[model samples]
Target: MRFSLIMVAGIALAACSPPVPDSGQGVGFGNYEEYQKQQRARDAQLAGSALPPATAVSQETLAADGTVVASNDGSDLAAETQAALGQGQSGSGAATAAGGTGPQPEAVYSSGISQENNFDAVGAQRSIESDAAKIAQNRAQYKVIEAEALPARPGGDGPNIVDYALATTHPMGTQVYRRIGVNLDGKAARNCAKYASPDQAQSAFLSKGGPQRDRMGLDPDGDGYACGWDPGPFRKAVGG
Candidate 1:
């Protein structure tokens, strides 16, 4: 019984020893040390195999209300920025908002100018031209001084048909003679009833008006003639 017990103990001890190597055709697998080396290689392969969680860096951004936030990655970045900043423009039109269009305000204009120039519209050249044209046109029309001739009235001692008192003695028998620039002639003078030499008549009329036959004894050298009338004053001066 003691020898049988010794053999069983020896068998149990061999069974408890480290596992043996595996030998296939020519290769051999060793014990725990080889297993440890294989474990280390497997750890390295796992480290290389698992892709490192994709590394990324994020930039910080500011919000409209001054708070910090992540930046947006969308395509409409500029539009978003404008909206957040409240910087968009509004008006009747784009041109009007930019101050580029529309009717201009009125400006004050004046007529008088100080400088001298040939083309000045408000100057003397225009006035002279207008006057010259008016005068030229007037000369072209038939404007005359004496329009027509008048006949002399017969005067004589034959019944003295023309009354000295009743007849109005205005020259040419018309008050139109008072107006200036008229062409007076001898025919107009013969219409007067009483005969006074032209000078005496004119002088007497200028002094007091009408016949002054009695006053100056104007009929001095007259043979029933008046106003120094052998030769009248004007004719005597001219020796006519």
Candidate 2:
């Protein structure tokens, strides 16, 4: 009974002593909260040191053969799809008629790019077809409604298709022969419509063709006026 009492008293004394620190910081284990904190820190450090296997962003992105598909951003989707299809054919024991080990690659098709950049947006195809179908009908109606009424037909197959080279009149109702490109390097080399007197211009115009002559591009607006030169004096003298 005395030995049992001594053993109990020794156990109590041991329990009362301060706990030793693991890191040898000379700091004894304090309260339960401090002990818990130290244990958590040690556990976290161990967890951080022993590295874990890297996990992929998505396992579905990998092909069945363990080759990583370069289709994370769908950049290689078409190629990957073609490869998968070929693999599928080979795996199915599909052989060529010549008894080849695997099926030969004939043509790999991808519906993704079948549009070929000519994608038909919603209603676009229907609109185009409708326009095409009604084009001839619309043209016929237009021709019937706007038929030209002429007193005499010109020397041509049709008025709409005039042979300008053979015809004399211009589209502007002026005589075609009057249209001439002039290169004036002398006599009136002025930049604009500068004239000493309108009489001189008027005389030159009448003799050669007044409105028909624009030697220096002076008549830019084609109002028979050149380089800011007024035709008032010329018009007045000629009663034009």
Identify the leading candidate in terms of TM-score: 1
For candidate 1, lDDT tens digit of each residue in 1-240? 999999999999999999775654225445667777898999999988886456754455667699877665543556677765564343345657478776468998866655564356556456878989998998899667875544555763232212331233232222222222222233233322354444444344324322422233322222222332222333434343
Clashing pairs in 1: 218-227
For model 2, residues 42-152, the per-residue Cα lDDT tens digits are 999998898656873442366668876554565466677898898977767544545665656799766654443555743555577787879978877774456555566
* TM-score, per-candidate, Cα-based: 0.19, 0.16
Model 2 residue runs over 4 Å out of place are 1-195, 231-240
Worst 10 residues of 1 by lDDT: 172-181
lDDT of each prediction vs. the true structure?
0.47, 0.52
Candidate 1 ranges with C-alpha deviation above 4 Å: 1-119, 123-131, 146-149, 154-240
